[model samples]
Target: MTGIKMAAAVCVALFLIMPTIAIKNHDVTEELSDVPFISAADAAHMQEYVAFDTREKDAYQKEHVQDALSVPPAECSECLFDALDIYREMNILVYGADDAATADAVELLLKNGFERVWG
Candidate 1:
């Protein structure tokens, strides 16, 4: 009877925890689902690279990659292209809240003939 009770308790605990695990996994999967992310270690190793923070001006001013350009996602594509025209030959790495921002910036850069763009 003791052994049976222990087994039943373990089973109940597993059942209770399984859904939480699944929910956490789903949330993790949704984050960065469409964006290409370079690991921090890998990013640190990039040679002659420029990092751009694509969040809002306030968020960027608060905290951003060291020496990163504050390129707000709300900027026009033409303006972005013009601002980054000089860096066309360099590696450009962008980061923001999500696809609507950072990923879109990456896409705009690529469309405007900026090579070596990433998020």
Candidate 2:
């Protein structure tokens, strides 16, 4: 009976933990891709879409993509979800000083359900 109880407890624990593990894995997978660099011309053309510069506020204030919104990497997701009211269908372009930061922003956007998320 004790062995059976142990097995049942283990099963319950796994059942509770599985979803969290899956969610974490999904989050990791979402952020694993490199963000593509968009050219100035292309960016110009897509001006209707929101362009986010995922850099520090100082760096963003210095200079960034023309007309791009300054959303620091740490606050990108919150800015998008809260301040911007960006719908999943909206074309959202995320960029940074380098690929890794851009990719991180993209992952966050994608995870948050932005369908047209691009970097």
Candidate 3:
């Protein structure tokens, strides 16, 4: 009777709260996924570093961080290591049109053993 009703109520409350918790967790993950890389400000502060803008040469030449270099993403697979050799022991920050593209370039740089890689 009364005890059975109380138990049912508790179960219903738990079920309702569970969905809210799950939704909040999902929202947090979505927000984090959208920001998969570091900020430009962090890249700017590095003492010894290279900023590689993976955008097209035209877009890169139009406007880029001071001292940044233009290295299109398509060409990165072949040239990143060679370029890094010129700045050995310096941090490398890769950036592009958006986070996804930047993240892809960062992954390639890391795989190729470019230490201190960032994006």
Candidate 4:
């Protein structure tokens, strides 16, 4: 039984590690040159901007930036677009639970012609 458990653990570990090993590392600086991702500090310095909290409502309710609007893109996209339409001309700053989530929201906004979208 111990040997079987050990073997199962090893297989699980290998399964998780394989994808990371197979993927190629990207140069973040080069990739971000044209991207609108900005540091939190830089975002703070900006005077006029509408910050969108892309996390779930529960997360937003727990804790979020002052005046940040909760618009979870994955949950209700129609509402997200509607909200975007209202603030189309404003500088939009998006943040989520993870980098991928934030990136996806920013990309969606950009595709929909929302300028000045930052992740």
User: Which candidate comes out best when scored by TM-score?
Assistant: 4
Which has the higher TM-score value, candidate number 1 or candidate number 3? 1
**Model 4: per-residue lDDT, tens digit, 7-117?**
343334323322221112253444334456765445445556777878889988987665678888766476668766878898787777765666677888888889889
Candidate with maximal lDDT? 4
Query: Which scores better on TM-score, 1 or 4?
Result: 4
| Candidate numbers, best TM-score first, in rank order | 4, 1, 3, 2
- Residue pairs in clash, model 1: none
Clashes of each: 0, 0, 0, 0
Task: Give the TM-scores of the predictions, in the order they appear.
Answer: 0.64, 0.59, 0.62, 0.67
Error of 1 at 119 (Å): 0.8
Q: What lDDT tens digits, residue by residue, belong to model 3 across residues 55-115?
A: 8888777766555677787776555668567765677766667555666776777677666
Q: Stretches of candidate 4 above 4 Å error?
A: 1-34
Instruction: Point out the higher-scoring one by TM-score: 1 or 2.
Output: 1
Kindly report which residue stretches of model 3 are placed more than 4 angstroms away from their true locations once superposed: 1-36, 77-80
lDDT of each: 0.59, 0.56, 0.56, 0.63
Kindly report which residue stretches of model 1 are placed more than 4 angstroms away from their true locations once superposed: 1-36
